[model samples]
Target: MMLREVNTQGETKSGEMIAEMIIECIKEAGHENVVQVVTDNASNCVKACALISAKFPTILWTPCVVHTLNLALKNICAPVHNPRSNEDVYDACYWIKSISEDVTWIKNFIMNHGMRLVMFT
Candidate 1:
């Protein structure tokens, strides 16, 4: 079910504020029906979950799976360094980064050149 959509223009996006917003939503939606709350793995969001857990002991707070997977992929694909030398080390997911860069370059190339874009279309 859709909950409140905060403006957050002049207000702070702190953990306390986020927790309060979540609690308000749960209360409005009938807390008894709420089994879990899911959010991204941001530090503030994690802290908000902790606060929410304290308020409603029965409710479980979980991180979004897609965000978690994106974090995992980012960590895995990030370039590493050898302890001995300045050489760069890459993992199996490195190819994904390469392909992404190539695609970006191709997109830019096509966008910048009107003739290439016309022919491709």
Candidate 2:
């Protein structure tokens, strides 16, 4: 269950804020019940998890596999040229871009629809 969704549109989500949010949730849920904390592998999230691990040495921090796979797929299907290089390294696999777009659409559909999201989770 999600504890809270902070409005981060214009706000800076620093490591301290993220760590505090997780710690707050842990406190509410009872510290002893928390064995692991999982978050997407973003730089700030990684830092936050590190801080959390330091605060609660027993609780393990894990990166979300889905996020990792999504990032991998993004790099493969939407290969951008390097700043110095003018060629697409994966131009031969451009066909995969359409499939990736469709997958993104499906994910957005499920996530946007309350009932579908509930069922998916």
**Total clashing pairs for each candidate:** 0, 0
Worst 10 residues of 2 by lDDT: 78-87
What lDDT tens digits, residue by residue, belong to model 1 across residues 46-82?
9999999999999999899978976655554554533
Q: Kindly list the per-residue Cα lDDT of model 2 for residues 1-121, writing each as its tens digit.
A: 6666676788788999999989999899887999999999999999999999998999999999999988867777645533343245567667777888998999899778879646534
Off by over 4 Å in 1: 80-91, 98-121
Question: Candidate 1: TM-score?
Answer: 0.65
The TM-score that candidate 2 achieves is: 0.75
Alpha-carbon TM-score of each model against the true structure: 0.65, 0.75
